[model samples]
Target: MSQATPPRSRRVPRAERREEILAAAARVFGSKGYRAGSLAEVAEQVGITHAGVLHHFGSKDRLLWEVLEYRDRVDVEHLEGQHIPGGLELFRHLVTTARRNADRRGIVQAYTVLTGEAVTDGHPAADRARTRFGVLREDIASALRTVADERGVDLAEQDAVRAASAVIGVMDGLQTQWLLDPEVVDLAESTAFAIEAILRAVLPGVEPLPDSPGASGAP
Candidate 1:
């Protein structure tokens, strides 16, 4: 009897292997958190030895930063080619972001855990996190200013800055709650409601942010 040839395995490129490792690392860190997540778990997920993972990523801290960068890259891509969003548009965008986050617990958890860790002075990602917040604040302030101008509301720059800060606070706080008790908290809906309230205080009679289609509400 003629022997059947063994199936040949295709070799992944070096870059491809690195990407696969990063994806597995993100999932592990997201689920187990940075301190609890281990290199072995990540390597196992990627079908590699622990040393192989280190060969690709150099160190766990560097890997964590890369994972965060990957998440941010994906997020920026999600908003690519979109129009410059104003107040209501910005709120809608944020609610949409929350809804999307609900589906990706891993990434959200990683971000949440890392942000808390970054508070310690001289943490590896501390500067990166602070820079990210600065950029977000600027974006929110710009949107607020646009909305105020469009509504003919006399909102001071300082007021807009404060409002931007409050908006970030609300989003992060709600995300933490939703992570802790997803069944009790509807992140997207709650965020939308809070944003609407803020808008009402700033621009009375302004149109509401649009609802997410097919959203399960509080579920």
Candidate 2:
């Protein structure tokens, strides 16, 4: 009998293939960091050539950007209406996200790695990181202002921005510590505590949400 040729692998749809590539790239970059990770490694994970990845993403820089965007998409994927919440609900949403993140180490790793790398001079992700922080600061600040208004408090704009920065700083700082020593740092609990503390400092006399983790008498 004549030798039979093996059938080629089935082709993945363009959209599906892009998702696979993004996922594989996230893992590679998360473990290796963006500067250390390679397109070849990302390609290997997806069972494709390095050129195949380029064909899909155009360039490594673009791929890194897309991966960051993909992370943001995942963050809000579970939200109702697929959008970030505003006002007091935003704070609750953040606490819920931190709790959810405890189970998503890889995604958190990718975010931390990329954010750290974005601080370097001439980094491709510098602009994106800066823009992201600016937007988040504004969003959080706006939320704080809304809460203040609801409580009949006159919160200054600068104070709101300051509190927003502190909130973001504590969250990012805790992620680094947790990634280094998860056994010692409870990412979700510590995040809830820090956020509550910041809110208390910024909005004195306002009570925490009834169901918040910090409302359970967490120190």
Candidate 3:
């Protein structure tokens, strides 16, 4: 009798394969800093060759940028309409995200690692990181201004920018500490407290910003 022929492997869809590669790359770069992680390791995890990874992403630099964008997508994945909130709602959304992030250590780790790496001289992700910070600061400052306007309080532009920077700094600093010792630092609760304090300081005499409708119900 003739030997039975082996079945051919099924091919994954392009979009699905790209997502798989992105996830694998995130884990690799999370565990091993971007400078240390290799495309071959990502390919090995995805059961593909290094050349296959390049075929999808062109270069490791492009792949790194894609991975960063993928992380941003995940950030708003749970929001209704995938839209980030503004005004007081933005603060609530941020606290909600911090709460959600406690369960997503891998993504948080990847973010923290890449951010730290981006500060190095001539880093490939330096520009991307800088742009991300600039956008976040602007968004947060805009939100602060909105809250101030709604409360009939006048918030100076520089003050709003400074407050925004403080909020961002606290959140990122807490993430780093929590990653190192989860048993000691409560990332979600601490973030909420810090944000609330900042708001109270910035908008003195204003009643606490009421939660947006159904905001409490967000996961």
For model 1, residues 169-219, the per-residue Cα lDDT tens digits are: 888888899989999999888988887787677677887777443333342
List candidate 3 stretches off by more than 4 Å.
1-16, 23-50, 58-65, 205-219
TM-score for each model: 0.75, 0.76, 0.76
Identify the leading candidate in terms of TM-score. Answer: 2
As a whole number from 0 to 100, the lDDT of residue 152 in candidate 2 is 87
The residue-by-residue lDDT of candidate 3 on 1-219, one tens digit each, is: 012111225488899889988888877775676577899988877877899899999997778778878866766766677767788888887887777667667557667877898999999789989998999899899999998998898898888998999999999999999989999999988988888888777878745543334534344
- For candidate 3, what is the lDDT? 0.79
Q: Against the correct fold, how does model 3 do in TM-score?
A: 0.76
Residue runs of model 2 more than 4 Å from their true location after superposition? 1-16, 24-48, 58-65, 209-219
TM-score of 2: 0.76
Worst 10 residues of 3 by lDDT: 1-10
- Model 2 per-residue lDDT tens digits across residues 83-158: 6777877788777767766665655776787789899999977998999999999989999999999898889899
Q: Candidate 3, 73: how far from true, in Å?
A: 1.7
- Model 1's alpha-carbon lDDT is 0.74
Ranking according to lDDT, highest score first: 3, 2, 1
